[model samples]
Target chain A: MRNLLAAILFACAAWPAQAQLSIEITGAGGQRIAIAVAPLAGEGALLDGANASISAIVRADLERSGLFRGLEVPRLVPQLTEASSVNYAEWRSRLADTLVLGSVAARPDGRFEVRFRLYDVVRQVALGGVAYTLTREQVRATAHRIADYVYEKLTGEKGVFSTRIAYVVKRGERFELQVADADGANEQAMLVSAEPIISPAWSPDGRRLAYVSFQNKKPIVYVQDIEVPKQQIVANFKGSNSAPAWSPDGRRLALVLTRDGNSQIYLINPDGSNLQRLTRSSGIDTEPFFSPDGQWLFFTSDRGGSPQIYRMPAAGGDAQRVTFEGSYNVSPRVSPDGKNLAFIMRDGSRFQAALLDLNTRQVQVLTDSDLDESPSFAPNGRQILLATIIAGRGVLTSVSADGRVKQRLTVSAADVREPAWGPLNK
Target chain B: MRALWIVLIASALAACATTQTPDTQPPAGVEDRAPGATRPAPGTQSVPSTPVTGVDLSAGRPASDAGNPLRDPASILSQRSVYYDFDKYDIGDEFKPVIEAHAKYLREHGVVKMLIQGNTDERGSREYNIALGQRRAEGVKRMLLLLGAREEQVEAVSLGEEKPKETGHDEEAWARNRRSDMLYPGEY
Candidate 1:
């Protein structure tokens, strides 16, 4: 025992830092997915002494998917010993779909190991056993990776918990652009300014963003390199300047400008050159979006009165009107499939994100909740991220295209609006 | 483009100066000039700028008698709006006869009001289309006034893409929506 102590001390003195990465995999297949994260129990237990508990972090990761309802118990550590052996039948009766067991231990050198095991309750099988070892400083990152693995195993879906979501939060006259973990954890403001920002679109590579800014006292679209947090105005057109929709290739953007005495459509490169006009109309033409295939561009106009949707060639051609059933229609976003389209339908003053099935010409209302706008599709096209009002506060929301999961992201209380989900990891 | 803007402004200002008198103006420079004759044709006198009276702006006619407020109100059943190819705003030959008959009504009816609601097929932004429809309606309004309709009796507004006479996602619906609707002041 004395030798073990000295060896640990000597190792600590000779090494940079003791480290490990712990991962918790959730169980799948009919058995409720299990996760085992317990609060640090012993004295001087490594993590900020249990503030952001490992168990709570893991639980939030599982719960936020609108999947994996968690196990509600007084404590998870009670089941650590065999003395509390697997009370299988009792657990089954308790409706525990899965069980997570884990413990955190610290070394004398300050190195720590968060070991966890996932068990399938119905099958009486262990799904995975792993340990995340890390120096005292890196516990949070370890917890996130564990969540990612468990999410991947159970849902066959890539875990976005380890990813980040950027949003524009409007506060009176000022607006804050914030970045937070996909689960709404660790939110921090990137830019705060007293200006209007509309049409925040993520580039295909995800390192840059393009948005319309009123910083010039006029509407000008800017391409912001997120890594450097640098903002450069790419378009400053005469008359109205708004609605910057990025091409799927991420090389160009479609926007509206009234430089010719009428609001017309123009495509500009991200570097602020090669400006090309796509529509020459005597009416108001705005809100241009390129099809995912990059063949056609869709937009909204009032040439026929009120507001309706129209399509034109991205390279410029005859403009064709699409929406006729409604008195007012605007802000069309084409789905990635080059099939269905999602747009904002205005019935009187109420605006909702409505979906159009190209095959059947059927319209589906994807959101019935309060004043929602700017619905954007996830990379998978199965879900949409948008901004909606919650408890009198503007918050980010996600609804599947089928309208199944209506989840409100738990970001800061600063009126978060205009959510644009980035593309999957390249 | 800057020169174009100047030309447009000058023409608009010029239009403001040439207000015809509401008299027995035979369309002022009322020319049965053969088609394809450009304005100011080589020493040809432009209409002497006469005032027009007793003309229907919607039906484009003079009053049947003195002080007649109502236009002849000819049945416009066969008088249909001519559709243009895509972006062309000029009326085709098929529509000349319609405009001629409509112009005759205005020359006879002393006082009449007409609203030409311009339109476009749904394919672009609602705001942009509204502007396009305005141009189309304004273009039609200009043609009617040039043919002798009173300026005060004609008003043009663009409906954009809101109303369509046909229902389909094809050429037929598009062709129908791309023309102006002649609306009587009190009629839907």
Candidate 2:
């Protein structure tokens, strides 16, 4: 019996070697579908070889989802780019349940056309095919869109590849608010200042960011257009004006302002008018976040003498405490499904990312880092992005919603923090 | 006595004008001498100029000031920072005397203005820390106001976790960073 147990352990260790990308999915709670993406065929130069770049990005997106395992397929005879030319027997032997093949061509009008086909190997049928006509600049976005399409078709749920992440990067005395792709690529600084920048909250439409900037030598909330680079101070109250969280409909923002004696949650229009107070706690009340339905607003408050997560009506009412397991829980970010709350919970002097199931009232710590904060959930509710300290430098990290598939994103020679994953691009 | 006051005012204005222009040299015997330095007999007793009344005008005063109580290490006003526990903005009993002393000073000198900067340790959400730090600064501001400091005399702002007194990540560093610092205008 001991030898049998040893053999079982050996098999567990050896099973991961069978896959090309050994994606360790810990808490997915389902069988991972095996998918293989063949290299795309192209004729001429397509933005530094678009065929390879596009397929790699698609494979990476699927693998990072923690729901799919990319299988290794050896170069087969007559590399197939079309669905009708695929040999089901060959891919079935390679053990890939789903296969993706594509080809790219540069058009005469400085545009590129990328066509892809998805095949079900075991069923010997074509799942689908799509052709995207995009400019050179839109190639990466088109790749993410294709990945989203494939993911939705396979998982029956929308993918988050088309989403963007906004974060604050501090290098020396300069601070930059940067927006990057979901996979931490194509970073573009939206705002740069000598003073500190914090709390980058993406608008519901993914076109604007509301963040706290110290450019005026005081913490003030500014809603900046991500594309046009224009900004207006949404909360420049006398005292501290910070912690901007947008409503789901993108019309309003719930923020924490200390204009009145102490810090309290207040709702304001995106145009910086029609101010309405939301919470009336005498203690420190801040970090206001709206539920996906826009009916409830979850926030962090210390009114009970200790910081904890609380929720109240979006219009305003009494706040009911939600978290009780830990003495310290703050920065509650509700998931897109409105069923889970991602927050930072103090654990023996170390703050870590945690998720609370709204239905079961069970809290699960999602990270083991010594200092983790600003837990923002992906639009699809499958991942949580947070800021953590690694080797004394602040870096951005993401963990799957179920506490699986962790990834660290670091900017060289800079400290990155306060990462807010934006809504899915429409 | 009236002539002495007029001479003091004239000398103060001359000192201000001299300091404002970079190329202007100090008048004769006042050349680069420290404040309160005694000069040799030249028929005129060089009265040192004080920019702000009742405030120390000297630079790099010793931490253990034995002459001036305002700069003395033992003076309550010298203790300019009030520290707090992790994520708690409540004023501790130990720091009440220190704050009361500053409040008394501010009230006695009605023209004195101070900026209260609240800071938090490097932990938790950055924006939330801003609120936490602001509460700490406001806590001190409330106490100062209750003790008779004018509301306009004190401007409270939160640096959040951006500025740290100590850069380490341990409890000691965090304890030192979670503090509210009292600053006179132009001090920062």
Candidate 3:
């Protein structure tokens, strides 16, 4: 099949996902889990766009992680497999409590096994499964690793459904950067540019990605490689190499430079050498962000004269500010259990997507948008993902870290910008 | 770095002595400004102690009849953009004679080489509009190096809010995408 679509474009860095991203989801995440998800049996004899049916992409990745409610598979429940047996009293009398069947076949050395399982059904017991083989361009990464093993075997957390996000879209004056599949489907572009691709980040072993790049006309910082086509540049110095981040031991990066003239916060390394200058503040320290146990960095500063959210000590010195009810906070983002931070506040001229809490400093707000901006969390710190401006274009939303559920995603005419969210593909 | 370029030339000479009456404010948008209206206005307009030479103050042109005064649009060095006010980055005394006619044509063409850029207006956070468009291209490269140009002939970067010119979302396309743009050097 054209050498399997050129080996899925030499193992992922571009393939069928041409604009993709359609999400939508909307609120609802407190008590869902009804489950059901069937249709796997040989996946309608496989091969027609081989992408969508590993139990309909694990029931839309467990109903877009608004915590599962799928349910609707009752044709007297038959094609069950993995040695089918107990109907669990007709899937707990159709209210389902949990079911998830699966099976794809096609293996005579051509690869595509699949499998799935996961039951429980009011305790008819099974809650286990596993299979995969893969090909057919990894059937949506084996249905997001079987919806991250049925969302960590039914919500004990840890399930960013095979993580991967990174955004930026533009379209007209071009842009691009992409990288999808955290339910926005398989998108892939990894750097297209005419100029402008803002702060993308994600490098804690989810492979690579860093970002910034106003082509070479200004904001530099690069770092590619999320499965090949390589990249590099890691900060081109002299005024505006923008907010890059990464440091959770993927060995340094933090960014935002102006080469020593204001937009401060430095750090470097990912091959751009040990630059180090971490915030000197004559004000405007520019979104640094790290704190996932890499000690602390979390940035964005108008040095207290407006743009807030601070933090410091990841080898830097005495800073500590962290958003005080918004005079216009900025993009901070910490959370992957660094206990919440997320940012972008501004509230009256309306910039939205707030969240703070890092141990009771409280905050919350989450999105009533009029222009939010790259918030990004979800490695399992439960949702977040940002980038707003709805009616006038640019989308990609997500929410839930108690801001209920939300979702969005868009991309029919392109605009989406800097999202990030990778790292749990492990 | 030279005390952040002398605190960005004392806040671009205090926002060029309080915006040189750009119609007494109240219009530029982006959080309405007005609080103590940017101080420094005791009499206004004054950073001009010389460097006017080839004269083109708003295009009265005479830089020896502009053979290349930045491709002469009647030459105020063809007024290569300066605008601002709206999360302000200063240099307003009405663009200071087109940045002193391109800082006297880059101090009489000492191997010219400009390139300012800076831009904003797509509202909030693209890395804080890239540090507010590198403080509006380092406040027009510190007013073209305090009007005589050459801190190695200017470089200043930022295209934050990512190159808009006018992709409209109101406030007259964000007042022409908050400004700075200079360019020169085979017009990059």
lDDT of each: 0.62, 0.78, 0.75
Top candidate on lDDT is 2
Can you give the DockQ of every candidate in the order shown? Answer: 0.05, 0.22, 0.18
Report the lDDT tens digits of candidate 3 across residue range A18-93: 6678887889787998988877777766656535667777788888888888987854445776656756886788
DockQ, 0 to 1 scale, candidate 1? 0.05
Ranking by TM-score: 2, 1, 3
**Candidate 3, residues B104-150: lDDT per residue as tens digits?**
88899989789887888887788888798888888888977987788
Chain B alone vs. reference chain B, TM-score for every model: 0.57, 0.65, 0.32
Highest-DockQ candidate: 2
**Over the stretch A1-426, how does candidate 1's per-residue lDDT look in tens digits?**
446444543443333221111112222223345443334343136547545766677777776555577766565444462223465676678777666666677766668877766666788776775777887666656666667667766677766666656677665445556655666655555555545455677887787878766555445678887777688878876434667788888889888775665667888888889988888877768778888888899988778856688898888888887877777677787777777888877654355778888677788887776456667776656567776655756666677677665676643435667677776655
- State iRMS for model 2: 20.9
Off by over 4 Å in 1: A1-46, A49-51, A73-91, A101-119, A125-145, A293-296, A311-324, A335-340, A389-395, A409-414, B1-188
The CAPRI category of model 2 is incorrect
| Candidate 2 chain B least-lDDT 10 residues | B17-26
Full-model lDDT, candidate 1: 0.62
